[model samples]
Target: MRLTHTGPAPARRDDWQTLKNLWPYIWAYRGRVLLAFACLVIAKIANVLTPVYLKDLVDGLGVPVAVLAVPVAALVGYGLARLTTGIFGELRDALFARVTQGAIQQVASQLFQHLLALSLRFHMGRRTGGLSRDIERGTKGIGFLLNFTVFNVLPTLLEIAMVTGILLWRYDWVFAGLTLGTIVAYVLFTLLVTERRMVYRRTMNTLDSQANGKAVDALLNYETVKYFGNESYESQRYDHDMRSWVDSAVRNQVSLNLLNMGQGLIITVGMTALLWQSARGVTQGVMTVGDVVLVSAYLTQLYAPLNFLGFVYREIKHALADMERMFDLMANHQEIADRPDALALQAKTASLSFEAVDFSYQADRQILHRVSFTVPAGGSLAVVGASGAGKSTLSRLLFRFYDPTGGAVRVNGRDIRDYTQDSLRAHIGIVPQDTVLFNDTIGYNIAYGRPAATQEEIQAAARAAHIHDFVTSLPQGYDTPVGERGLKLSGGEKQRVAIARALLKSPPIMVFDEATSALDTRTERAIQEQLDRIAQGRTTLIIAHRLSTIVQADHILVLDAGRVVEQGTHADLLALGNRYARMWQLQQSGEDK
Candidate 1:
């Protein structure tokens, strides 16, 4: 695997575009959005009217009259306003909850599909811990942006607008001026301070992903670490990642405290100035106690969400930062994409061909060069070479994981690229040199080869792969859980499980890539017998290191540095006493020793 781990840059956000990406998912529930918004507006309006009732109640109570009857209407109206504000506020939340959840689900599902669709090159270089953390944060950010941007931010702004307008209309331009100026100051302070604080937040995010990546990497390679006794080294590496997080987190908190102080200072000044003006008006007899009380009431309504508004704005910025990574992942173009006119694979004979295929993982270093070969229907071919002879590249090419840099790969006389990738893959089955099983039950892993396979079919495939008897011996049988990457099972057992999975697939073309290499000699012989039976009447390609295993192949291709050095039946190659004969003699000597 290529070790260049530089992934997409995660911190930069075209905020407008990133937020716009979420719009469609949320807008898919347009009816709910509109109704929820209407409820929101009504709730804010009632919240604004709440103070108006207080003015009347205060005036009625302050009046000097013979009979001081209770102001029942004002009292009841005040209660109703509060009730309306809360009830409708809750209703809005109830209505929009589904939209929030649905958008999150849709976005998460799309991200998952995109991740799967990404090329193997990306997967090979991907830091699993980082990728997983990005996805988790991004999904969470969707919910926060959807709920708070609409509910918290918008409502606060609407309430501000209503309260300022009421102050201007009820009293005079001076009161409104103080209210608007205070809002402007508060918002400006928040935006400017929060903008500067963003660097700290972004720093925290970068370090967090890196730290998580290190932790996960260490854990996944647990056995390797134990073997080397590098537990301290791994811990030090993870701690190194977190040290930067610690710095940034401290700076983030410091900046936040600065921001809060600035906001509070502006709020205190604004509140005092407004109250002082109201006091002067009351003393001058221009404003009654009712008006002063009303102003105070509206101030409470405005500033409560207003304080929360600052926090909401900060959180929204952080949310955008989190989502930027996931969206960047979404923006990553597929290295291999289906042609617009791609056809489903249609193969009657299941013949496989590599036509002068020249390929490379990188431009500086080529792998296969004009290497051509073919396996006719119901025929088997074995590829043997020293390590790094481009053995795996051929299998990947057949699966269309990466198109050859030059030349073409054909399945059933058609360029594999002409067929949709999924369809082409459906026609081929491979048991790779390294079998990585899913962290699931034996039954689940086998069934994954064909998800619709019944228990009977699973058992039959297991028996064919010579693993059913062993599985039956376990107390849980097929229900036994394989731990992460099937680490709980031995190598031979994992190989058999892989074989069973491949058998369950029952594709027209089969590739056994060192399929028996992991087993003991006796087990290899037994599984090889079953493989020979299964390969009958099916096109098969075997990439082998053990020469004896492939002697029965109808043809053998000897590769030396990505070029075909010899090709003939096993007897013919041995008779020539060339590369294939020498390799055979060497392996025979090793076996004898």
Candidate 2:
């Protein structure tokens, strides 16, 4: 979450090198770019030529001028040229936006796909708000660079060069050299000032990210704020972040305005002087009035592009900053993918085994240590452990959320690593401790496990999970809308929906992770019966919290810290007077009172 304050200035070789990186996407739509470029060139040329018609009118009006209609016709012709050029200019702008939009979409899609391929470990360490902002800012850069840098800045640059060369060829070298020198000074000064101002802009961008991050974090935990009566605290914190953002914005604006005002003053004084000189030459009969008129028009036209140049340059630099962040994410090496020749598991057996497994979320502190166990096909096993003692970590390994730090886990006598990641997980169904549901119809949520499931199949699964009566009793029945994360449902209801989803998945192996640990006694008892029914014929693994709930499991492993300290059936463990017996005794004693 460290924010970048100020970016380094670009080196002499930076633009060319950076632009080379952008070239692949640019080349993809080369034909479209060329067509738009042709339109822009034609528009600028028509604009430059229009001034000649104005010059002709200024010089030829009093001469043995042709009929009055001739001058009127020439004026109309000038207007038409400007009009035509304006239309083409707009067309070029529209096409540039389209091309840029396409690039934005393409880059966004690539970034999204890359994110999906990253390991769960990567996501675990990053804030959701920060990640989202990074993605949005990165995609937006493409559109900004494509439209402003390519269409406006680059073309205006060429126009300036061409106009200066034509002035030298058509008139005195003095005028040409002066205009070139003024342009050079203008560009250099603007760049220097803009680079300074960019320091403030970069700071503002950092604050902007913080503000976005804070807001997203607060909104996601609004329920906690309400429950704790900490709304004022959250509000004050948000306001603090917002005030910082606003102060940065004000500083950036003041500096930008200073740069723009200075540039404007220089352009006004230089243009006035250039035009005054041309007029003097015309008065001395060294130049025609028409020539002076043409020169004045060219000067006016040039200033328009010149004023916009500063703004476009600023955008280009900002775009580069954004592109760098985007490229960083794009350049991240995705987690290891399935091998090229990976094969799906052959469903010959439902047996699961762990051999000398060791794992940890952080180095030097293992969660599961050299734990080896096997479940016979279609057998049931329960793992009981204190909080943070590796029960959940073992289940994660079975699903391959993380490969073992040492040793291996196997399914059907084959190392799980040998199967494609997707295929390996496909046969495992889990009812997590915290059940999550999307905002959708009840039927849709239940059908999520198998999207192509028939209505009858869905109803059957819901009935089997004992949620059909409740669902059908609702106003909209199965079509009822569940609010975000199923906030509308009770905890027990949410768990039942999850059970229904897993039942529909019909996976060969089922895992229940403290499925009833957080419920009331009555609710836990009800759900436990439903779970017992669901586990009848499958290879079931239960991570239990209440010792009573797992008494009927065929085999139970008592985990202490990171090792299996005791193992037996309920009666055997009770008779042994071990860790499990003590835990059961504590619970039973509490209940007896």
Candidate 3:
């Protein structure tokens, strides 16, 4: 199978469109947002008024010493203005906290559900580590965008406007013009530099994801690397990716420093020009010392947001890039989806049929071709074949993991596609050749077959699978922790756990795909006996590699190269002295030796 290319490309810098898409989530808490905006406005007003109080206090100091009350009042008012500004800013953050947190939760939850709803093919092609990292970065991007764009970016612009208006009115047009020109230049420079830095940022992000994917893949296949004695090989591979990440990170930092230096140069030039003009006016007696101080105070206030704008600009670009990746993931369409009008499966007898079916994972190769078979209600069918003869494909087809390319799979005389996938699978139970359990307790793994099963029911199923005695012998018994993929248990023990799980499901139809292949000879015989007892009145399909295991099957099929070459009872096939007879003779001879 081809690996999917799920990584994002360099996205279009259309931040407004992305924000528009996020409007529904933001709109959900519109009331709180409006209140926050009100608080923001109050805070800015207080901030703007603070400088006016400063101007008054400076002017009041020039008054006669006998009248000290004027200067004292101005000082008090200035302090009150600063305190009000801080209070209102804090209130604004408090009011909007719910909206920001709610949006994060809603977006993360939706992305998780969307990933689950995606088709199995999509999952097969994805790298788990990279996918998870994208999700983490995406959620963090949401928080950054909401907080910075709303609070920092918007408030900065508002404060700039208030400062400009005050300068234009209280001072001359020159002061306002200089302030406005400086702001325009700073904005333009920041945007241009930030756009250039985006390339480095994207490279850094890609390298980071590659390193993470490498680490996770290596760890997950730890046993495989050890078996091959390739521990050093794996380490070198991981280090290669990390080295690339380090290089990209250094380049990213270098570009950022250059951008900061350029920004500082522009701010210094603007500040010097403004201060020189204000000093000239004071010397010419056109403006008092108080006016000069006020203009300087205004410049200081304006510089704060101007510097913040640089940080905000960079963060916004990064956030947008991260969000673009998440949105790309969301854009993946499900290859298999339920029809709008699909109904639940109503399997009264659990009969199964594969009629003239054809299938392939890729167009170049077909795995099943015109294969047909049936299991009548309460009847058993055994299919024996060599590897790649399409035995396991039948089980996957029955489970609806992939729809047949041609013809149909039916259950109870109705097309399985006519029913919802969930309901259709609910009627079938399977015990596969390989079993992988969670890194949880033994009881948790068994109870997974039926989440709501009672303790008694779980023990009964364990007894039916002949594993209850083994479990009880342990000190922890059912509560014993099963290590990753149940590696702590022997192969035979894991197989027993799988059997118990299938028994607990207790569906009307059962498929055993080499279920006893992992067990020892003695354990296989015991499990085979239990399996025979369980299949008495169930619709059973057994795919087997060992010919001796199915000698008592109600019907036997011998498949070669995806075709059913022989079909008969064990005695009749042996009497015919054909393929089945040859296979059985060979197996019995090998066992006797």
Candidate 4:
């Protein structure tokens, strides 16, 4: 496996385009969105009118002692306006909750389904922990974007417009100009500083994903780590990744402090100048005490939303970055898509053939060369070869995991590629050399072969593979939990479970690829008897490394270096004194010793 230091490339996307892509999900709840918008408008109107009520109350206070009753009315109106503002804001949030949740659900479901539909080759190259983290962060980002953009950003802009209009109409253009200038300066500073900080944030995100990936990968290979006594080494590797994350996090925090200090400085200077102007007007008799109070109240209200605007802008950028990763994952194309005209496989006699097949995982190195073979209907063929002789490659080719580089693999005289991959695979059953079970109950794993299998059928299959009695003896019987990859079970037991699963499938064509390699001699003999019974009247292909195992096979092919060195019945090949005879003699000699 190739280990690379860098993470997946950052996605390049226009923020508006990404938002446009998300519009469909949001548009589905247009009615709720409209209701939420109406609530927001009502809330902003109440908020804007509250300051007017406060100005009236201050003017009432300046009246004689007999006019205190008028001040009482103004104070009551001010309190009611504030209460209305809060009520409408909460109502808006309630109205939009469904839209936010529905959009998140829809996007997450589509992304998950698309990921599953991707080809196995894509999965082989993916880091599971990192991919899962991206999905999680992306979904959360969607919620933030939907909530803040509609509720916070839009409302803040609306309030700013109302305040600026009020200031311009009631006073001179100087007050409105200063307000606009301060806001523009604050926003520019936030945008420029946030752009600089994004590099640190992205680096932090990448390191976090890498750390999680390393932890999960190590845990998944817990047995290997223990066997190799590499626990300390794994810990050190994880710590090394965490150290990088810490460094990035420190830089991100430092930049955030700089942004906050700059924002505070701008707000402080703007508030001081506006208050100074209002005081001068009052002293020069150009404005009443009430006008001064109104201006001060407006400035206070404006600053609240201004500070919140800065927060909204920063969060919006972060949400876009998170969403970019999710879109990248969705953008990956399917490598092995079925043709539009592909048809379901039609199996009559279940005969299979490899017609002058050649294959290679990479172009630089070849594995199979001009190899041809046939398994007639209701007949068996056994292939014997040493390691790296391409025995396993035959199984992968027959299963259509990868197409042959040249020539074709056929079922029932038709090229396998002509059939839909799902339909073709449904007719073939395989018991692979390594059996990895799901982390579920034993019965669940067996039932996976035929999801609708009855209890009697599942038990019958287990009995055929000679594992039913052992399962029954356990306290939980079939319900016993199989730990990760079935590590709780011994090698021979896992193989029996795999055999039971294949037997339950009962497909027309079966491939036993080193199916009994994990069993002891006695268990292997017993299981071979069951395999022989099942192979009757079914087309079967066996790939094995043990020479003694195929002595009773109807026909045997001996392979060496991707070439067919000998072929015939086992006894006939022994009589020829070729590669098969030499392998049989050496195995028998080793067994005797």
By TM-score, who's the top model here? Answer: 1
RMSD of each: 2.4, 3.7, 3.1, 3.3
Tens-digit lDDT track for model 2 on 58-148?
A: 7668566456766777688799889978998988887777678777778788888888777778877766776788778767877788788
Residues 1-593 of candidate 1 have per-residue lDDT tens digits of 12223233344558899988888998899999999999999999998998888888888887676534545677888999999999999999999999999999999999899889989999999999999999999999988888788889989889888888888887889999999999899998899888788877777777788889989998999999999998988887777768868888999999899889988998989899899999999999999988898998887877788888999999999899889888889999899999999999866559989999999999999999998988998899999998999887889998989999999998888899999999988889899889898999999998889999999999999999999999999999999998999999999999999999999999889999999989999999999999999999889999999989999999999887888889999999999999888888888888522
Every model's TM-score = 0.97, 0.89, 0.92, 0.89
RMSD of 2: 3.7
In candidate 3 the C-alpha lDDT for residue 551 amounts to 85
Model 1 segments beyond 4 Å from truth? 1-11, 64-70, 591-593
Q: In model 3, where do residues sit more than 4 Å from their true spots?
A: 1-17, 65-73, 346-348, 591-593
Ranking by TM-score: 1, 3, 4, 2
Comparison by lDDT, 1 against 4, better one: 1
Residue 277 displacement in candidate 2 (angstroms): 2.9
Task: Tell me how far the alpha carbon of residue 91 in candidate 1 is from the true structure, in angstroms, after superposition.
Answer: 0.8
Candidate with more favorable, higher lDDT: 1 or 2:
1
Per-residue alpha-carbon lDDT of candidate 4 for residues 1-593, written as tens digits (9 for 90 to 100): 22335564354468887798789999999999999999999899889888888888888988999979887988898898899899989999998999999999999999998897687668888998888888898899999898889888999888888888988998889999988899899999999999888877777778788888888889989989999998988887778778878888899899989899999999999999999998999899888788888888888888887898888888988898788788778889976666788889866459989999998887998999988999998889999888899888898889887889999999898888888989888988888899999999999888888989999999999999999999999999999998998998999999999999999998888899999999999999999999988888888999998866777777887778887888999889999997788788888888521
TM-score of 3: 0.92
Error of 1 at 501 (Å): 0.6
lDDT per residue for candidate 3 within 227-273, as digits (tens), equals: 99988877877677677778778888998899889889889999999
**Model 4, position 448: C-alpha lDDT score:** 83
